[model samples]
Target: MSGLYRDVGVVLRTYKLRESDRIVVIHTKENGKIRAVAKGVRKTRSKFGARLEPMSHVRLLLYRGRELDIVSQAEAVEPLSPMLSSLDRASQGLAALEAVDQLSLEREPDPRAHAMLVGVLRTIAAKPSPLNVPAFYWKLLAHEGLRPQLDACVRCGDSEPSARLVAFDLVEGGVLCRSCRSGQAISEPALELLRDILGGRLQSALDREESPVTHEVAALATRALEHQIERRLRAVAMFERG
Candidate 1:
């Protein structure tokens, strides 16, 4: 299999290699995450110069190499121009890309992960919301089977409709009831927003504008994602500072 193969993927990140070549990390629909060298891509007239940029959804032809795969041909399925039009959109979009890069494993075939990445990018391009990136993070965590329990306490099996849930434990992976109150303090509105995010009411949550509740949700989601990835995302930090 040391020859040409084709795949569709989203460019997760890229780095400089030599004088004119670049290393691209892509999350593909079939082969999962791959690192490939785009030869001479930094040159002015390189065919794949623009096609291989981070956040681009691309279809590629690659030649298997002893070490890094070589990108032979690339075509853009979805360019990231729309999402990069503004600081707000770009920041959120880039943060999501970093999340995908962190969560994806090399050579692991995860079609669902690929689908989710493309879906979120398309959503951000069409309608950039404050909730979009955080929602993506939460959903990604859920897809990875680390979904935080929202219906009841993480400690006790309290499912009463009026059971007091006051805080979220990022380490424990769920909400804490009044008796087991710890971690980030969760307001009633914030808790409801979390439910809407994980409980099949995503559109409703996305339509709403930014507020204290959204901020709380974003913070919790960011912390949880950082915990899962075991490192800080540069894009998320920059977006927050900006």
Candidate 2:
């Protein structure tokens, strides 16, 4: 556990370094999230150039360096090529990467986060449901202990049954009852959809006619995640732009 390491991970993103090298952002199962320099990867005949591309799942051999780890070798585990076959699938995959990249820290072990992302990517590749993206985000937040409080008034902890979610407070981190309401108005349907998302009902929750509040729920999840991680998520922004 000193100067060298090996891990199986998914490529989150890559930044070009000089002309023929790349700095790859990866979410590794054993070593958590990390960035390592893949030297000469941009060369015409480089071994790992294709394997190190974003959203690729591969096993990497790394050597510790003073500044950045160097990728000594890379072998493809699951290239995840299907997820990149269409624009929709590709967007979902990249957004998933951005979400994981923002939520996780470098060199931290997060098996739950890692598995959640890998599973979500596999699901998206198969189904490509719109709700899957937001559901993935909310689920990741729940895993990180940032799930929005939906069962009661955030201020009073009043658990009395109410249809309308009424208001949501990002700072308070949940919904506020009518009596304790100084938050953004959100509908009961939105709250229910969010609940289903957390409960792993991606397809069923989105099976009916699309509700306007569904977009609101996605926005809320993004805002909540950004609030916790304190980083603006380009995943949400870019996905919406498309």
Candidate 3:
């Protein structure tokens, strides 16, 4: 296991190491999430510095090290360009990366998670939407089997169609009927938007323009994801502030 291995992954983040090196965290197709050292990457002339930037998708050849892997070679597959140029898209993309980093276990092989991250970056770059980040959050939660219950009240299993679901409880993990109402107030449109995101009407939901309902859904989705992960996503705050 102390030799070279090849993989394609998106660089989730990077930090300074020694004078001319960096430590990068990436979520790979074959190896899941990994931490590796990129030597000489801080210098202006370093060949792979841009390729290893956060959100850049690259194919890598890395030498397995005892504590960390060494980047042997890197070729950019999708450079971080257009996404970084727009503040909104950049923050959303970073939030997605942060969420993946939070959920991914080091060296765990999860191809679906890798694909989801890559797809999200591509989506943010090519077709930006207010719902894109929220949709990603919901889809990721669903994949983790932590999806919020929508068909019936999570508390007391109330399924009366006449009883309107008027609230959402993050801790309880679902919508609540009028009787069980607690936590944030939720509108019918917001609930329908949540269902659309998780129930195969994703395209329509994503295509809808920015509205109060969409904003409500986005806020709910962010809170739900943060609740599950139990950490505030810094990038989310950056975008919201911008």
lDDT of 3 by residue, 181-237 (tens): 888899999999999999999989989999999999998988888898888889877
The candidate scoring highest on TM-score is 1
How far is 52's C-alpha from truth in model 2 (Å)? 0.6
| Candidate 3 error regions (>4 Å) | 240-242
TM-score versus the correct structure, for each prediction: 0.96, 0.90, 0.96
Off by over 4 Å in 1: none
69-121 in candidate 2: lDDT tens per residue? 89999998875779878988998888888888888889899988988888888
| TM match of model 1 to true structure | 0.96
* Residue pairs with backbone overlap in model 3: none
lDDT (C-alpha) at residue 4 in model 2: 84
Worst 10 residues of 3 by lDDT: 233-242
Estimate every model's Cα lDDT from 0 to 1. Answer: 0.89, 0.83, 0.90
Candidate 1 lDDT over 119-186, as tens digits, reads 99898988998999999999999999999998889988686576788889988789988888888788
Rank candidates by TM-score, best first: 1, 3, 2
88, model 1: CA deviation in Å? Answer: 1.4
Predicted model with the maximum lDDT: 3
